[model samples]
Target: MRDTALGAPNGAALPASDVSAAVGLVGLAGLLAWIAICRSFPEFVGAFDLALPAERLDGPYAALTGLIAAGLPMVLWSVFVDKVHTRDSTGLDWNKRAEGQSTRAISFTKLTGLWATWAIIAAVYCIARWYWEGNYLFAMQILGVAIVPMVVLSVPYILWLDRRMFQPRDGAWHFGAFLLAREPWDREKIIGHWRAWIIKGFFGAFMISILPGGFTQVVNADFGLLASQPGALASALIALLFVIDVQIGTVGYITTMRPLDSHIRSGNPFLAGWLAALLCYPPVNYGLMSAGGLLDYEINAPGWQHWLAGNSMLLSLWGGWMVVLTAVYAWATVAFGLRFSNLTYRGVITNGPYRFTRHPAYVAKNLFWWSASLPFLVTSGGPMEALRNVVALSLVSGIYYWRARTEEAHLLREDAKYREYHAWMAQHGVVTAPLVALGRAIGRGRGEVLQPAE
Candidate 1:
């Protein structure tokens, strides 16, 4: 019922998450360290009375540097502590590298597939009108600069990586074989190859486009003043959490290297999965959930901040709760470490918030939306307006529920460990156990018993 990454085997006992709780904290520590540096660097120079620029480092580039600060430490932790590079999941054999010459022919075909995938993604970026506008323009510019280097460097990267892989005729090679029509290719693998790239290209650009805005907001905020105003303080805290999310999420999208054992094992191949995810982003989200969109829920709602004004206690409590929800959402991403992405399975993670519930991020997020939006309390229009707002927001929640289901379905099919974890959670998870019991009670009322996992 829940999506998971690497974890223990099936048992009556709750399984442990393969990723330790410390991994996310390590990344968070790195990010906080960079933030501290950014805030204090100018002051440090001024204290020394040196002839340095002595300017604040709260620019977009500094925000980008935060990703490096966060990512490099996590990479080190993964390699040195977790020894993730040696995992069977990585498909790497460091001690026994394959003779490079033997795999060159295969590498050539894989390179063709990889390069062709990049071209198609670039062309799509070109065709999409939105990519040339607003923040997407930043993403396009970054990608444009990266394209030449990516093309030139992929030659050695693919060749080198393939030499160490146990069996290197992966999905990319199959896609290349299909393109050339000179070798046999698995239809499913080709489809899979396309699916993985589509997830990467689309989400990668979206994540990068959003990176700077939240970061800038946090970096530029006046914390001293915000602390006096609950609403403003909550907004600042939420922005900071989102900045953490975007920064770590961008790293997850970009760091899909086999050496890190964080490569996408498979994209969710289901059309339903893709549709559910796509509806939550960009042009689709604009059409379906934006201000003028069909499912727009904020039509005349004044929101919690408006209704709770002057009630200091309520404002403080509400704001604090919202911050907690956003923090949980951010923590979910942090727990993914370097493997977070939409519609893909890198591995199963049962640590962090996953120990309690399968979809902590989605659950916390929807709860936050309901509390913050207060759709039932409208400023204008009558009961009908409030009703419509509630329904619309409910449907939006439904979409997230749909996403959770599809993600679970995809993971359940891909990994047996997930199946074991799923069963264990049904019986033992603190949050999931009660939900599972209630579900069974309902099913029993209808004379339909739920079957146990095989």
Candidate 2:
């Protein structure tokens, strides 16, 4: 259940519009960083206490904008790749196929019932979590920022989109009403997504949590990117791109990941999912990164080097990698478009950033984390601390390494084409193949290939 992200010309890695979009995102990041540096917006030091009504709306509003942004590439896909206007892919053009259409029609009653059930569950979870030590205000905020957007705006918009793009001639396809409805679950679904709803809910809630502070960064005249001061430059980069990626990635996740590929074909091993999920959520994502009040929640990478001051040349280096890191994350996720998910193999992507490497997202992310951590050297810190940092950071990187390896193995086993693809990528990748071979050699060729079913 995947859609083609590319209508690329003759196996090209990127289309012309993609280049434009990438350039545009990067330019926007640079400008926003500059503004944050020049203006010192929102005064994050004062936190939400200083936020006005407009600033408060930034997060949820960003979610709206992100969904719109996700649609641009998708709309392009429709026009150029899918050519949906003149032809419907649901086989709706033939009125003679009512039986298949009948099976496809989502029951309005069932959909409404399921949504009501989920709504009640989500509300109860929100409320009970409050009693179980969740913040009441945060719960309310979740309702406003996350849940409300999903129900009132996001869900309906998607349903309408389904009606617009994939409607059957007899109007039998009601799966629009069943947008969040479950398809058939595979074994992998049993464990990796123990908290699927909560994760998605929070994932959606992130825009709500992040956007206002981003606006505040602008408002406070913390103007992001500026000349000369590397410290201010880094702050600006974090202040801006940090917000942008979440919007872009979240939109990608919702548009493609949630609606299109929620059904995981394979679950990652426990270690892979645990470590990745940990980095994605709380204390790790923000606790170590933030310098002040609302600053904590921003997606900005903290010190690649934990011991250094915020205003340091070392962190500036980390910032460069951070940019690469975020860009790669976006590239990989966007390539999947509608197939993005954590700890799951729903589809294989061969174009875009993926053409360069089999594990672009994990590789880029690990590089970013390592650069941020500044391990094995006393570049700005003592040897003991550096050594300790190296060990901890290495562990985190290792998790991703396992993720990449396991992901390949799982994908290869699941799809025969992916197996051929694995062989091809291993032979052809400019940078990744040799690196993978080297890793295999170091592991004594362990995990190099799967055994033939014992």
Candidate 3:
């Protein structure tokens, strides 16, 4: 006989086997109910709307009712069973046993089971759709079923895989940790240790560029861009462009950042801010285009759509230019490391593009932003588009002016090196000294010249 006392000194309680049968029955019932609801749902059958099924509301209502009944019972059973197990264990939580290994195993098993069940259901759905509607409807149904779930599942799977594969048992940094760290200053050491650099650069580029764009495109194609004609060719093309921008922009930033890391780390907020702005700007601009109906291929030839398309095209041109310039700069920096001493005053870069102008990159980036606005204007084909472009350009220019001065002052503190470079540039008038002088004047007026770093 089992001991009735909770956590009795003598181990007299019955083992878990006593309750296993009851738990199995409850779990099985819940699973069956959930499957029934999912299989019968109107959303499952009516997704394409190619055919008007008999009894329009029955599928949806039955699914809804089944979902609630199935879900609530399972939740209650699990909770009650857990509570009972805890009580039987003499106030010791059964969840704490075996270092929580049992609970984890159970969870893993349940998740795997659910996944397999869903996969089977999807296969059945596709087969049924093909039989009822035709091959085209079957294809659409498969895509509808697969795409969203795949993306959602990918994130957790990646994290889990990374933890299992890349996480060191020793004290070494994880992959994420290494990516986030500042690059060391020694050029020879960095060049020699090429593997680390490659890994960091590759992952950083993918994260910042490819993933966001690709994800956006996938989501947009799945739901947003509805085709009047059978094939969603136009939506597909725009989605492809978004992916390209992400990849190009990511590579551009990574290359630029590799070269500028040394100078950027030297506490020059202007340079750092500029780099940050470049890194962050593309996504925001793209998002704006998407939000404003520029990316919608279906809504053509009028109002917001026209403006969006025109501005987007303009932005793309500017973006392309910036990518080219950044690529060139990155190549020069890596190829001719530390050779341009005059350019590197107190570890601040002031050569190449810098020789012609204090902030060539800034100018390029500003132009890029302005260019993005151009597409919107051209698509709209009206005066309103031009007016919007003017406002955007003005704002970008003003911000650039403010950031450039702050960067210069930060560079000056490393001693006479930066100051000497500044004086030399001013005297020779190699670049437009007037522009630098004007920036200085504005910076001084705003009392922004000497504000100490926080």
Candidate 4:
């Protein structure tokens, strides 16, 4: 087995690998130190209110000591464990062969060193927490410290065990094999395109962050409601929504990562602009809402009718806008599908909202954010709320313009048909069509009028 896919590029320095390993070890050490020091002082734990009940502390402390004792042997084994590369298939033979292998031995030593350090740190933290009465705090700290190494060790262990138990054949390593096995529709090119846009969307969100503060200030100032009152509940809800949106966005990203990796492997661009847009926009909107006091859900009023009337109209508008944007996104996705396919040379996705605006999903995203801000305009109870809406709208519009430009550039490269699309849009004025047409007409008549006057 050549393992060509896993091999490093020719002439590449191995120093990069060494440096990464060193950094990982250093980080592990730092985390251990932090846990140890924090656990040492009872007063420190008391200051943070981490102290635990007197009766329950001893058992946990004993358990912590036992864990440390048990982990020490594994740590020592890790230190001695060495890798051997040879034509032989037997595991023990490979280990014996690696007895003098410098690189393999060093790697194992480092791993074992870190494992021992982590185990000891965990023991110290647990002991401190149990005897010192900050049991919960100690447990949280221990769990946090344990997580990274657990992940590092568990993943490899499972993979190795799986290989030995089920597929004992040589040359069976396939990156993203799990994803490929599950989703036959997963294509490499589409994943690459989607990943590229994900990066772009994240950058765009960062840009959007800069302008929302002014919008938030304006909205908060105008609403006249005290921050501690009716505004609080609204603000809290807005924040909660933003958090949910971020969590979902993260889920979407995870769901797509493996596919994107596969797409890159196949030298393709998986262009899912609408999907990326939907994932990225909600966070930006939530952040803006929080900044504008719209998320402060603590404040409530007795006039249910007023609240209903105000919020109802805004919600309706938002819903309508969402529909419109969704339609547009669908159209874009469909229209550009062929071009994206030709460029990245990959899969076809014609389901769900795809029948609508080629990029209906992206459009839905735009509508969602825009509509989300409407409550600030109507229920905000002050001028600041109105200002927040205006500012948010402007920022969103700017983001769309930026996104459109990038999307168009990508389209042009992927498909010549995009040139014609651009020309058509220019002619129709797209979003700014009326203004552009008016300008052209005025420019044409002005020359004649000026010549006649002269």
**Top-scoring candidate (lDDT):** 1
Query: Residue by residue across 400-433, what tens digits does model 3's lDDT show?
Result: 6566555566556554445555554543434445
| Candidate 3 residue runs with Cα over 4 Å from true position | 1-265, 268-346, 368-377, 437-454
Q: Taking the tens digit of each residue's C-alpha lDDT, what string does model 4 give over 82-194?
A: 11112121221223322224333233333343344445545654554332342244435445655687759744443333332222211112213222343222244334533
lDDT of 2 by residue, 1-454 (tens): 2112211122323212211234324423443443443233245534546544323224334334444544465545544554533432222232333343343333332335335545755676556543234233433554555655556564444343334333321111222233334543233333333344444454544443554455445435333235465556665655555555544555444543222322334455546544656564554555443343221221222344345556467656766667767677656665654445565565556677766777777777777666654455554446665665666566656656655665665675566556555555554566666765575566665744322110
Residue runs of model 1 more than 4 Å from their true location after superposition: 1-11, 48-54, 449-454
lDDT of each: 0.86, 0.48, 0.37, 0.34
* Displacement of the residue 270 alpha carbon in candidate 4, Å: 17
lDDT of 1 by residue, 1-454 (tens): 2323324443545556656667778888999888877777778898999787887677667877888988998889998998889888898888877888899999999988888889889999999899999988878888899899999999999989988898899999998888888899999998888888999999999988887787777777889998899998999999989889888888899999999989999999788888888999997899689886888888898788999999988999999999999999999999999888999999999988888788888989899989999999998999999999999999998888888888989998998778777877776778777887787788799898542211
Model 2 scores a TM of: 0.60
Mark the regions of model 2 whose C-alpha exceeds 4 Å error after superposition: 1-66, 69-73, 76-81, 84-109, 120-124, 127-199, 206-208, 215-225, 256-280, 283-322, 376-382, 440-454
How does model 4 fare in lDDT?
A: 0.34
- What are the RMSD figures for all models against the true structure? 3.3, 9.2, 25.7, 20.3
TM-score, every prediction: 0.94, 0.60, 0.32, 0.30
Deviation from truth (RMSD, Å), model 3: 25.7
lDDT of 1: 0.86
Q: Which pairs of residues have clashing backbones in candidate 1?
A: 4-348, 4-349, 5-347, 5-348, 5-349, 6-348, 6-349
